[model samples]
Structures are given as structure tokens and as C-alpha cells.
Target: MDHNISKHISGNFNQELENVRNHVLAMGGLVEQQLNSALDAVNDSNAELAKKVEHGDYKVNAMEVSIDEECTRIIAKRQPAASDLRLVVAIAKTIADLERIGDEARRIAKVALESTAKDQQGLLGNIDNMGRHVSQMLHDVLDAFARMDAEAAFRVHKEDAKVDREYEALTRQIMTYMMEDPRSIPKVMDLVWSVRSLERIGDRCQNIAEYVIYFVKGKDIRHTSQDDIERDIIGK
Candidate 1:
């Protein structure tokens, strides 16, 4: 949490804001766990675990609603200004992304449940590797948001490109496998969809990182070039 917002403030306004931020972080933690479980289901081919991930999504959804309501209440009652308003707005947007990420995790879990591919060790390994990267990106962005660190957020933004490259590689490999073995098409297609979900998760993480930058600097860097973002963040 950023102490700058709470400093010198009296009464419960700061406390309420802090509570909202904490709830968002808690929601983030749950989503991260859901993502990890979904990946485990893929690597182990455990349908039961995938089912668990699906069921766990309800919790994430509930938290998102709860946090959004709290933010709205704060806005109605307190009408914060400047950085305080930025904090609330950023958190509101972040939870929305988190909810979508949860949805993608559930989709990946469904893929795991449906896949019946044999001799998919190589494909599963690629998915596991991609999962790790996206998972780390999620963790890093959440931390950046909590600390209000724009520089850390920029680092996460850069990592998304690497994830995109890995996703492209996985797609190519899956396509080659499908071409060589028509019988494996069904299973390969499921893996392809699962990787697609993971790639989308990476994209969402990048979105959250951009929100962190916005929260910290009050700049909307969406659709801006990387060079421009670099210059803006570094004050060049």
C-alpha cells in the first residue's frame, strides 16, 4: 500500500480506501492460484483439478463484485480527488481485468478436461512453460500495483512480448503436429485453445501493468509506442 495517500488523513476515509485496495489484492491472489491450478490440470491431465479450478472461479467473481461496490460507495460518500481518485479508478479497472483473467483460466481448465491427447509430452511441456511465464507476469504486475511502482510495471510490459513469441512458437509446433498426424487433430486443437487462453492471460497482465503506470503517473499509455512509454517513464 502507498503511505502517501493515507498520510495526514484523519477519520475513516483512508481506512476505507485501504480496505478496497486490500480486497483487490486478495482477489488477485485467488486468481493467481486459479491460474496455477489450471496449469497443473494441464500438465497432469487431472480432470478433477480442472473441475476444482472451474468451481473456484465463483470466488473470484464474487470478490470482483464486492470490490467494485466498495469503490462505488467510496466515490459516492467521499468524492476523493487527485491521487486518491486515481487509486480507486485504477483498482476498479484492475479488478475487471482480474475477473476476465479468471474466466480465461476457467476456459483453460475446460480445455484440460476435454483433452484426450496421447503422447503429448512435448506440447504439455510447452504449455507448462508458458503458464509459468504468465503466472510470473501476473505476480509481478500485482506487486507493482500494490507498490504503485511504474518502473516495475514497465518491466512487466516488456515481458508480454516474450510471452507472445512463446505463444507463436507453440502455435507453429501444434500446427506442424496436426499436419503430420491427422488422427491427433482433436487433441492438438484443444492444446492450441489452451495455449491461446494462456496467451490472452499474458495480454491481460500487460493491461494491468498499464493500469499500474496510470495509477502512479496519471498517464494513459494505452496504444502508445514502447519507445514513448520508455521516454515518459524515464523522464527523457
Candidate 2:
């Protein structure tokens, strides 16, 4: 009985909405697992683990398609209004972000598979640290979504700043490595893409946080400054 899901006269309608929300959570769980495995693949340089992560992207894509279709059917049949409509819209947007996060994880896994030289692999510093930070942000934002707590969502939104800082530091470190030895460019470039993917995943998590705020407050905060968002929404 999430307050956002209306208690309809028709019990079936209530159940349908609940089922869709549950499906979104299940998909979130799978995507989180995929990301953790991708990190392991990179840290261990296990080609087998990396290949498994790349193969798992299809499952994420399939779930996104299924959830989108279900949301469309709900809109067409239920014609929900107010909070209910917002819930459907939020779920649709959240899944799209989750799918893209999965894509970034797959991209990171590719870095492991592409490394041909041990020395080239050694050119990059430990990415697992930044990977863990983004992973926690994703987990927190999803928790905020499940509870539909706008304040909690805002807290998660703030964490993206730290991820950005980490990405910038890593980029500078990797660039220095390439400059010191231009011969490592080819392998280091793959590492660059992997770190960039990590940053993009942070952005996607922030997008989900905005969707949560939108669903609960009925306010779209996209392209808005963090200071303004707090003053306009959470500070109130």
C-alpha cells in the first residue's frame, strides 16, 4: 500500500499497478548485480567473467522492453490520473536509466577483454574504488525510489558530486600515464572509456533521483541547479 498507488474500486486495477512497481524493483536488482560483476571482471582481469557480464546485457534490455509495454498498457486501459499517472511515468523513466546503467557496466567489462599486455593493464590505477562509490549511489537512489521519499532522493542526488570528482582525478591520473609512455595509448584509451562509463552511470543515477522527486512532489527538476532544487523542493 504505497501511498502513491491509489486504492481503486476495482481490486484488479490496484493489483496491476502493484505488479508493475514490483517488476521495476526486480529489474533494478538485476542491474545492480550486473554492475557488481562487471567491476569484479575488471579488477580480476578475468576474461571469462567479463564475457559473462557482456552476455547479461540482453537480460537487462529484455526487462526494459517488457516493463515499457506493461506501462503503456496500463496507461491505455486504466487512464490513470494525478498521482497514479505520475507513478506510471516515473516507472517508465526509471527503467530507461537502469538500462543505460547496465550498458555502461557492459562497456567497463569490455576493457578487461581488450587488454593484451599485463604492463598495459598495469597502466591504469585501481578503478574498483570509484566503481564502488557509484555502485553505492545507485543502491541508495533505488532505495529512495522504493520508498518514494523525495528527501532521500535528494540526498542521493547530492552524492553525484563526489563521483564526478573521483572521475576527474582518475582521468588526470590516466592521462599522465599515457604522456609518460605514448606507447601505452591503445590500451590506456580503453581504460579511459571505462572510467567515462562509470561517470555516465553516476549521471543516470542522478536522473532516477529526479524522477523520484518528480513523482512525489509533482515537480520536474531536470536541468535545474542543485541549490535551486533544494530551496524549491526539499527545503520547503
Report the C-alpha displacement of residue 87, candidate 1, in angstroms.
1.0
Q: Model 1 over residues 65-85: C-alpha lDDT tens digits?
A: 999999999999988887778
For each candidate, what TM-score against the reference?
Answer: 0.94, 0.93
lDDT of 2 by residue, 38-125 (tens): 9888888878988998899999999999999999999999998877788889999999999999999999998878764666545444
Number of the top candidate by lDDT?
1
For each candidate in turn, give its C-alpha RMSD to the true structure in angstroms.
Answer: 1.8, 2.2
Query: Cα deviation in Å at residue 13, candidate 2?
Result: 2.3
Cα lDDT for residue 236, model 1? 51
Relative to the true structure, how large is the alpha-carbon lDDT of every model? Answer: 0.88, 0.87
